[model samples]
Target: MIALDIENVTKSFGGVRALTGVTLSLNEGERLVLLGPNGAGKTTLFHSISGNILASSGRISLFGDDITQLPPDARARLGLARTFQITNLFAQLTVLENILLAVCGAQKLTFKFVRPLDRYDDIQKRARALLEEWNLVDAADRLVRNLSYGEQRQVEVVMALSGEPRILLLDEPTAGLSPAETLRVMEMVRKLPRDMTIVMIEHDMDVAFEIADRIAVMHQGRVIAEGDEAAIRGNQQVSDIYLGVE
Candidate 1:
C-alpha cells in the first residue's frame, strides 16, 4: 500500500524557488533516501511533507488521505513523525525524563503538569523499553547535556519513535557521527519494523546506499533520478551530475 503520495509539490521563498514540481511516493515498509548536494532542496522537501512548511502548490497525502491542510501536530496525530538534522532535546532533563516527556507529548497529556511526574509509570516503562531497544539503557539516568553526541542522537531517535508513527521521516540522521557511530545508527535504523515506511534526506552516499531500498536524487528543486541501489549506482545521469563522476 502507498504510505505517502506527493504530487507536483512546489514551494518558494520570495523570488527563490526551493522546490519545484516534485512528485514522489513510498510504499509501506519501503525505505527511500533523498540524495543531493548542498542547497538541493532536500530539506525543503522534507519540511513540506512534515507540515513544517506548506507547499505553494500540489498535494500531499498520507495513507490515501489528503493532508495538505493539516498542521504539524495534526500530521503527527495521523501517524507521521520526523527528526531534524540537528538534535532537539531537553538539555537539563535526564535521558529517561526526555523519553517520558515524549511519551506524554504523544499522548496529548503534556498539559497535565500539576500531577506528580511519577504518576506516569506506564510512560516510564515504555520509555525504558525504547531506550533498551536502542541500546541506551545504560545512559537513561544521565542528563541529556552530559551524553555524547552520538548518544544524544540515539535519544532523539527514541523520541521520534516514541509516538509509534506509521511513517518515519529522518533528516541527515547520521550527520556528525564517526564511521563506527554512523554504522551503529544505521544498524538501529535497520532494526525498525518492516511495516514502517521511512523517508530520509542524506548527504552520505554510503549511509544512504546501506539503508535505502530505493534512492531519489534531487537537483535544482526537481527529482532528477530515482531507482534501487544498483540502478542508481549505474545510472549515467546520476553519476555525471549528482554522484560526482566524470
Candidate 2:
C-alpha cells in the first residue's frame, strides 16, 4: 500500500520557486532517501509533505486520504510525524519529560492540565521503552540542554518515534554528527519498524546508500533521477548533476 502520495506539487515564495511539479509515492515500509546539494529544495519538499509548508499546486494524500488542506498539527494527528534538520527539544525538560510531552501532543491531551502527567502509566512505560531502545535511558533524567549534540539528536528522534507515526519524514537526520555519530544514528534509523514508511533527506552518500532502499535526486526544485541505490549511482545524469562524478 502507498503510505504517501505527492502529485504535481509546487511551491513558491514571493515569486521564487522552491519546488516545481515534484511528484513521488512512497510505499509502506519503504526506506527512501532524498539526495541533493545545498539549495536543492530537499527541505522544502519535506515541509510540503508534512504540511509545515503548503503546496501551491498539487495533491498530497496519506494512505489514500487527501490531506492537502490539513494543517500541520492535523497532519500529525493523522499519523504523520517529522524530525527537523536541526534538533528540536525541550531544553529545560528532562529527556523523559520531552518524550512525555510528545506523547501528550500525539494523544491530543495538551489541554488536560488537571490530570497529573503520571496518570498515564502506560504512556510512561512506552516512553521509557523507547528511550531504552534508542540507548537514551541512561540520560533520561538529564536536561536536554546538558546532553551532547548527538545525544540531543537521539532524544529528538525518540520524541518523533513516541508518536508511533505511520509515515516518518526525517530532514537531514544525520546532520552535524561526526562520522561515528552519523553511523550510530543510521543504525537506529535502520531498526525502525518495517511497517513504517521513512523518507529522509541526506547529503551523505555513504549514509544514504547504506540505509536507503531507493534514492531520489532533487536538483533545482525537481526530481532529476530516482531509482534503487545501484541504479542511481550508475545514472550519468545523477552523477553529473548531483554526485559531481565524471
Candidate 3:
C-alpha cells in the first residue's frame, strides 16, 4: 500500500525555486532517507509535504486521498506527524508536560484553557507510556531546557510519536549530536514499530545508509537519484554531487 504520493511538487519563493518538479512515493511501513547538500531543497520539500508551505504546483496524497489542499492540523488528524530540523519544543515545560500537550493536540481533546491536564487519565497514561517506552521516564519531570541537547532531541521524537502517527516525517533528527548521542537517537528510531512509515532528512551518510530502506539524493532543487544503498553507492552523479567518490 502506498502511504504517501508526491508528484511533480514544486515550490518557489519569488524568483528562486526551492523545489522543482519533485516526485516521490513511499510504501506503507517503508523508511526513506533524503540526502542532499545545504541548498538541495530537502527541507523545502518537507515543508511542502507537511503543509508548512503549500506547493507551487503538483499533487500530494495520503493513502490514495488527495491532501494537497489540507492544512497542517488536518494532515495531522489524518495520521501524519512531523518534527522540524530544529528542536520545536516547549522549553519551559517539563518533558511530561510537552508530551501531554502533544497527545491532547493530536486527539483534539477538549479541556479548559487553564485546567490541569492530569484530569485526563487517558492522556496521562499515554504520555507516561511513551516516556517509559522511550526510556525517558527518569527525565520526565525535568524541564526541557534543563536536559542535555541529546536528551531533548529524544524527547522531541517521543512527543512526535505520542499521536501514534502512521506517517512520520523526521527532519535531521541527529543533526548536531556527538557520536554517542547519534547512536542513542538511532536506537530510539530502531525501536519504533515496524509498521509506521518514516521519511527522514539526514546529512550523516552512515546514518542514512543504515536506516533507510531506500534513499533519494537531491541536488540543486530536485531528486537526482534514488534507490537502495548499493545503487546509490554506485551512482556516479550521486557521488559527484552529494556523496564523494571514495
Candidate 4:
C-alpha cells in the first residue's frame, strides 16, 4: 500500500531551483530516511510534502488523494504531520500539558476553552500513555523550559505522536544531540508502532542506515540514488557526493 506519492515535484525561488522534478513514493509502514549534504533539497522536499511551501510543478498525493495545493493545517488535519530540524514546542507548558494541547489541537478542540484541560478525559488518558511510552512519566509536570535539551526533544516527539498521524516526517530529529542522547532517540524511534510510516531526514550516518528500510539520497535538488542500505553504501554516485569515498 502506498502511503505517500510525489510525482515530478519541483520548487523554485524565482530563478533558483530548490527541488527539481523530484519523484518518490513511500509505502505504508515503511521507515524511509533521506540522506544528503546541506543544500541538497532534502528539506525542500519535506516542506513540499508537509504543505509548508508550494511546489512549482507536479503533484503530491497522500493515501491516493491529491493534496498538492492543500494548506498546511488542512493537510495536518488529514493525518499528515511533520517535525522541523529545530525544536518547536511550547516551552512554558509542562510535558503533560504539551501533549494535552496536541491532542486537543488534533481534535479541533483548541478553541474550546470553556472546559478545563483536565475535563478532556480521553485526551488526558492519551497524554498519560504517551508520557509512559516515552519514559517521561516522572517528568510529566516539568515545564519544557526546565528540562534538558535532550528531554525537551523527546517531548517534541511525544507531542508529534500524540496526534496519531498516519505519516510522520521527522526532520533531523536527533540533530545536535550528544552521542548518548542520539542513541536514546534512536531507541525511541525503533520502538514506535510499526504501523506508522516515517520519512526522516538524518545526517547521522550510523543512525540513518541502521533504521532505514530504504534510503533516498538527494543531491543538487534531486534524488540521485535510492535503494536499500547495501545498495546505497555501494553506489558510486552517492559516494562521490554525500558520502566521501575515503
Superposition error at 203 for model 3 (Å) = 0.4
Regions of candidate 4 where Cα sits further than 4 Å from its true position: 109-119, 243-246
TM-score of each: 0.93, 0.93, 0.94, 0.92
User: Candidate 1, residues 89-184: lDDT per residue as tens digits?
Assistant: 999999999998888788672334445665477677888888888888889899999988888888898899998899999988889998888888
Tell me how far the alpha carbon of residue 114 in candidate 1 is from the true structure, in angstroms, after superposition: 15
Residue-by-residue lDDT tens digits, candidate 4, 139-205: 9999999988888878888788877898999999888888888988889889988988999999977
lDDT of 3 by residue, 97-199 (tens): 9998998887673333544554488788989998888898999899999998899889989988987899999999999999999999999888888999999
Error of 1 at 63 (Å): 0.4
**Model 3 RMSD vs true structure:** 2.8
Collision count for each candidate, in order: 0, 0, 0, 0
Deviating ranges (above 4 Å) for candidate 2: 109-119, 243-246
- Between prediction 1 and prediction 3, the one with superior TM-score is 3
Order of the predicted models by lDDT, top scorer first: 3, 1, 4, 2
How well does model 1 score by local distance difference test? Answer: 0.88
The alpha-carbon lDDT assigned to residue 68 of candidate 4 equals 98
- Per-residue lDDT for 20 in model 1? 94
Q: Please report, as a residue range, the 10-residue window in candidate 4 with the lowest summed lDDT.
A: 109-118
Residue-level lDDT tens digits of model 2 in 1-246 = 999999999999988899999999999999999998888899999998888889999999999889998899888877889999877888999999999888867766234444565558767887888888888888989998998888787777778888789989889888888888887888889889989999999988888998888999998899988998789889888778754662
